[model samples]
Target: MKTFCGILWEGVRKELQMSFSAFFRLLLGALKSFLNAETLQCQVFTSDEENGQLESRFISLVSNDDHKFTCNKKILSSKSDVFKTLFAGSENDQCVRFQEIEKNLIKIDDVDGETLREILRYVYFDVVDQNIMDPNPNLPFKCLLAAEKYMLDQKFKDSCQDFLVLSVDDENAFDYFRLAENLNAEQLKLSVGDYISQYLTHKRDVLP
Candidate 1:
């Protein structure tokens, strides 16, 4: 009976030891995973900080109305050939420096404050807000002109052209046709011609 009890006790002890050993191994693996995740997160954060520093370099612009705007230099240069040339000039000029708090001051004499603001919004966010344009029918035209002057992407000009095409009516068709001609927008000119032809046909049909 004593020998049997000793054997049973010894077996239980071994089982408990194995259980504890397995539990500790699992715990250690979990701890290692947690530490590795933390390290990866830290590395990502550091990389983001570095990129943020590069993106924060800015330049100052003054509109014809004297409204001032601060813009990201990299974004402006990357988006527009005109801005790229302007900033490239700054490299040779002593007046503009990336490290300077005053930044490179550019004067845009053709574009007014409000129009320039919209242009910058498109430059940064790639959007033209229609809510603002709806109340002022001339806003899209102004933005279109600015887009051309600044040498913005053709996609942006297309957005403005689309808005203008939608806003066309009997009252503004002639003016819009002239605008399309000046911009050399074949699509808009064609659309205006079609609208005018249909309108004149309908008017003739209803006449006494």
Candidate 2:
């Protein structure tokens, strides 16, 4: 009877030891998973903060750079011609209309940096080629077409967004305009137009 009791006590001790080992292993695994999750979240947040800072710098460049240029050729090459034709360059003239339009465009904030560069490039080339403003009424549509071609020639996201901002208003704008234009499509072009229109018109739920 004494031998049986001793053997029973030994078996109980071994079982307790195994149970404790298993519990400890599970606890360690849970701790590891928690640490890994926390680390991943921290990395993502850091990346997002960095991106926000970069975007702020880009916006400052556009707003403070005094971009004395426009997307129209006539405006760049013959600022006088545009002024004369549109406003007669008179003190009490239509030049104010252009100025107002410019002021509004300038007030636009949050345009992507790459998009601004692409738009600047397009405007620069248009000035060189003397094709900024089309003689025809369909010129805005043509601008969209030109933007598509430009985006295709150069693979950049910034240019595409600039083009979209400038041309999305026209009724003739294409459905897959970004794809056709060779522009970078970070998001759907239609969605972009919807957002812009909403801001401009103060109408929400108007996105297609």
Cα lDDT of model 2 by residue, 34-136, tens digit: 6543221222335778866433222112322344222332322232232234323356442343323332133213233333443455443422213323333
**Model 1 Cα displacement at 152 (Å)?**
0.6
- Consecutive 10-residue window with the lowest summed lDDT within model 1: 36-45
Point out where model 2 deviates above 4 Å: 1-131, 136-152, 155-164, 170-184, 187-208
TM-scores for all predictions: 0.64, 0.21
Number of colliding residue pairs in model 2 = 4
Tens-digit lDDT track of model 1 for 119-175: 888887778887756678788889888777677888788888888888899999998
Backbone clashes, each candidate: 0, 4
Winner by lDDT = 1
Clashing pairs in 2: 73-132, 114-158, 115-158, 148-181
TM-score of 2: 0.21
